[model samples]
Target: MTAMLEMRGVSKSFTGVQALRDVNFTVRAGEIHALVGENGAGKSTLMKVLSGVYPHGSYEGAIIFEGEERRFRDINDSEALGIIIIHQELALIPLLSIAENIFLSHPPARLGIIDRDAVYRQTRELLAQVGLREHPDTLITDLGVGKQQLVEIAKALSKRVRLLILDEPTASLNEADSAALLDRLLAFREQGIASILISHKLNEVARVADRITVLRDGRTVDSIDCGAQPVEEDRIIRSMVNRDLAHRFPERHARIGSPVLEVRNWSVYHPLHPERQVIKNVDFQVRRGEVVGIAGLMGAGRTEFAMSLFGRAWGRNITGRIALEGCEVELSSVPAAIDAGLAYVTEDRKQLGVILADDVRKNITLASLAQVAPRWVIDDVAELRAASDYRTRMRIRCSDVYQETGQLSGGNQQKVVLSKWLMTDPQVLILDEPTRGIDVGAKYEIYCIINELAEAGKGVVVISSEMPELLGICDRICVMNDGAFVGEFASGDATQEKIMRAIMHNKRTSNGARESDMPMEGVRP
Candidate 1:
């Protein structure tokens, strides 16, 4: 079979920074090509070149598609040729209906007026193809992340996509959703649609990809043919990061202490829907030198409980009794929460955690600006010194502290978030999906940091969707179902089966609880 697409001698640079070296890549007709790399490894950049995000003259390369050389001046040029790219950060107008988003660029129209019936009729067929059962008139914001992802694909299909590129498509999706999406890709292959999948989930890639391309620091390292032999995940990791990963999670020695932070009868109502209780009345505690993991299905109220406790970021009419070091404290707002020696690392890092446009130095000092300022006067020297120290200590891969956080890879971006919260010097830290979408090596490093945080006598609470991750790192696991904690297990007693059983048991007994998993996109592969 002849190749459908070929990139020859592709090299791109930005202001003296070489983002991609001389690279060669090829995708055959009707094949699922998996691209693997650490964050900032040039996978996205190469895709940008293909999709015309960087345009034709921005880089030096020859893009031969379907037996012809092509120079796409812009995204429209690429889209006109049946090439469409779906971004991980979903781009959808929340207020608009599903059909509208699907046919946003080019809708069926007569005399420059949209034909509504044609839009709905065609959207229904596209949605069915993607296995999404939502009505065409349903608002995009009403759907979960998983469904939104499908809508993006359906939108791509609407454009008559030939070469589909997905960047970190399943980074935020749960195992089931991720599996379904991969299966959809296979189905698309049956129709002769070639897919270029970029993801950090090695298991998913290994399961679905016909060919695997590894990129490291702007260079093509290897292109393994799965048809010839199964690709080992460790081998892929070694090529992507230039080192053999000895472990996914670091070993830890526990030194349990007395309860450092305690919460009693905590309750919170939905911010908008006052009648709806988001967090049920609950009692929770975190001991000094302890890493406690909250394990639950998506929308099981884990994040709601954490965010509510962190100065009621997620809910209103909150009622809670929080005691730190045996003294009850009132945290009515975010500033008060911070003043009370509490820090929360949010799950929605792109939106709530990091200011993407800001340089690393400013972001590092954002949470605790008082330290870098005295008497309301700015101190640039102290801030720079502190940020520089953290960049080095966290091993944040960047050109310098002056570089924008958005320019860093996912792993490095996560490290910067961690650095920001650590700078606050809080007594208790709450980390929500701390290692989500990062590479295996980066995950291990984050695990080590968590362990070190516990060792330093700072109480830690971790909320994660991955059962194995919670089991691997936490001293104890608390299972939350619906809006409350249903079960608790010591690290020795905790198992994925037991945790899941707790959830199942809760669902069976409570009338108000979700009988099935909540339709929220979560978990990391």
Candidate 2:
């Protein structure tokens, strides 16, 4: 196969900090090339250089495509040559229809006017090619994450993309959706479309990648050809981190104790639909020094339950009894929830976890300003000391406390989020998809943090879509389906098969109906 794209000796630096160091990468025509690395390892940086996000003259690099040395001045220059990149965060406008988003920049025009008929016709064809069965008029907001991903691919096809760059495309998708997306990639491969996939999911990489490239500390370390021999996950990890991670998760010996957080008959109604109940009456408990995992597929209402528990931040007509260490607390608002020693780490870190525009110090101190502000005035010295303390404690790698949060890598940014919530000194913390897009090394660090929190006698509740993650770290796992717990398991007893079976059995028994139809008084998992 001919080389479709090549980036040779590429280096990018940000304010004296080198993000990429002479990295070399290549992708064959009609091949799926997987780029694997730890956060801050320069994978995304290298991709940016190729896609013109960094642009020419901004970075040291040589980009060769189809036997031609390309000097792309901007993303438009790259796109003009059939190179399209879909970022980790989907760039579609929520208010626009699918057809509009697909052709927002380069719509089919007739006599200097946008052609609505041609736009819809082309969008329908692209959607069909991507195996999406939706009308062109459907709003981007109305589509699910999986469908939105397909829309992104469809949009790429609109530009006649020959080389597709997808960054963490399936990080937020469930198993079925991810599989569907991968299948589309395989189909694209058959049609001679080359793709560069950047993902943290090793299993998925192994399944699809024709070649694998490993980058570490801003440099390319190794490139494995899957056609020559099989690639082991451990080998890739070792190359990426420069050390052996014998265990993906740190070992934990939980010391369970008395209940620290308890909820009885918790129910939440949809904010928009007054007649619909999003969360059924549920009983839940988290004990001191215990790590509890909530395992559920997408749309299982896990996030809804967590948000409603945290001062009714997400649902309407929220009725629940929350007791902290045997004392009933009134969590009527976010401030009250914080005052009651409850903290929630959201899944969408970029949006809800930390302020990207703010510096690391401000983000770390944002949640507990009162501690750094004595006499209702923020003391700079005290704030700096507190923020620096967490920066070291959380192992957050950044230029300094003054560095912008957005400038840090994904893993480091997540540490900042954890540091922010930890400053609140909460007794019980709920982490929703805590390590969603994080790499293996960073994931281990996050797991260790969760263990340390539990060891400190804090009740920790983790909600994750990855079953293996829950199994590897949690002491207990609860299977939730259709807004209610269907089964529970100890760490020793839980398996992916068993947990999934419980969810499937519940769905079968209920015939896809929610527990909301039942009376709230006697409902139990």
Candidate 3:
């Protein structure tokens, strides 16, 4: 069988980084080829070269598709040849309707006027192809992340996309949604549409990929063909991280201490829909030298609860009683919350975590500019020192403290987000999906950092979709559902089944955290 696409002698470099080097990749017709690699291994960079984001003459490579060599000067040039790339961060406009977004660039028209009926009529067909039941007129913001992903596919189909590129499509989706997306990819393969999938989720790759290509440090490591033979998950992990990852989490010698922060009868309403209550009457607390994790589904109010408590950054009709060291405090704004010794790390890191264009030194000192600046003027020396210290301590693999956060890898970008919040010197830290896009190796490092923070007598609150992560690092795991806390389990007593059962039953099982259950560190699923 003739190959659908091929790349020969591909190499790309940035100012001081060689992101890709003489990489060779191939995909067959009607095949779902997965590109797997650790963060910063040149996976995205290679895709950029293919999709024309890097453009012709920018990288030394040959991209052959449909048995013809081509040079794509921009994304539009590549799209003209039926190649569409959907990035991890969705490009859909929240305010626009689904049909409008689907054909925003080009729509059916006569006399230079768009045909609304024609647009909706064609949109319905595309939506049905992707199994999205929503009406074409529905707003993109009204849909969940999973549905939005399907909408993206629908948009691609509208363009007659022959070769589709999905970058970490399921990284933010839940299990059921991820399965549905994979099923769609399989369906597309049967219909003769080739796909290049990039993801950190090894299980999905094993299940869906016909062939897997591994890239390590800007070079192709190996290619595994599932049709020829099955590949082990551990082997794939070893190839990506280049080490025996015997454990995904680090050791934990926890010493549970006194209560550091508490909240009582917390309630918040939706900012846009005033009548809709987002967070119901909720009571939560975290103790000194303790890591408390909140477990829940996507819309289970985990993030809303965290953001509402953090200076009401999320909701409108917010009503809550918060206390620090057993004393009630007012947190009406973000600055006030920081002043009250509270820091919240948001789940949507790319949008809300740090300024991507800014350098590491600036982002680190942004949250604590007052400390670095003795007067109202400036202090570059102190700021650079603090940022450099964090860069070394956090193991942020960058050229230097002056390196832009945007140019770094996902794991390093996450570390910079942590550095900014840590510089605030808060007694209580709330981390939302701290390691969402991070790889397994980097995840263990982050777990170790959390343990270190707890050992320093700081209260930590973690919100993650991964159950094993919560069970591994949290002293107590709290099951949240429908804007309320239903149950709590100490580290020892907490299991995936038990915690899921708590969510299913929708009832509180324990009164508070207990240190006697088990240690969360070094435990595997």
Error of 1 at 357 (Å): 1.3
| Ranking of predictions according to lDDT | 2, 3, 1
Clash counts for the predictions, in order: 0, 0, 3
Candidate 3 has a TM-score of 0.95
Q: How well is each residue in 1-525 modelled by candidate 3, as lDDT tens digits? A: 789899999999998678899999998999999998888999999999999999999999899999999899999998989999999999999999999999999999978999998999999999999999899999999999999999999999999999999999998998889999999999999999999999988888999999999999999998999999887888888998899888777878888787788777789999989999988888877989999999998899999899988888889988867878767788999999999899998888789998999998998889898988997755888888999999989999999998889988898899999999998989999999999987777888899999999999999999999998999899999899999888888999999999889898998786565332323222222
Between the candidate structures 1 and 2, which one is better when assessed by lDDT? 2
- What lDDT does the true structure give each of the candidates? 0.89, 0.92, 0.90
Per-candidate TM equals 0.94, 0.96, 0.95
Any runs in candidate 1 off by more than 4 Å, and if so which?
507-525
Write down the TM-score for model 2. 0.96
Q: Which portions of model 2 miss their true places by more than 4 Å?
A: 507-525
Off by over 4 Å in 3: 511-525
- What does candidate 1 score on TM? 0.94
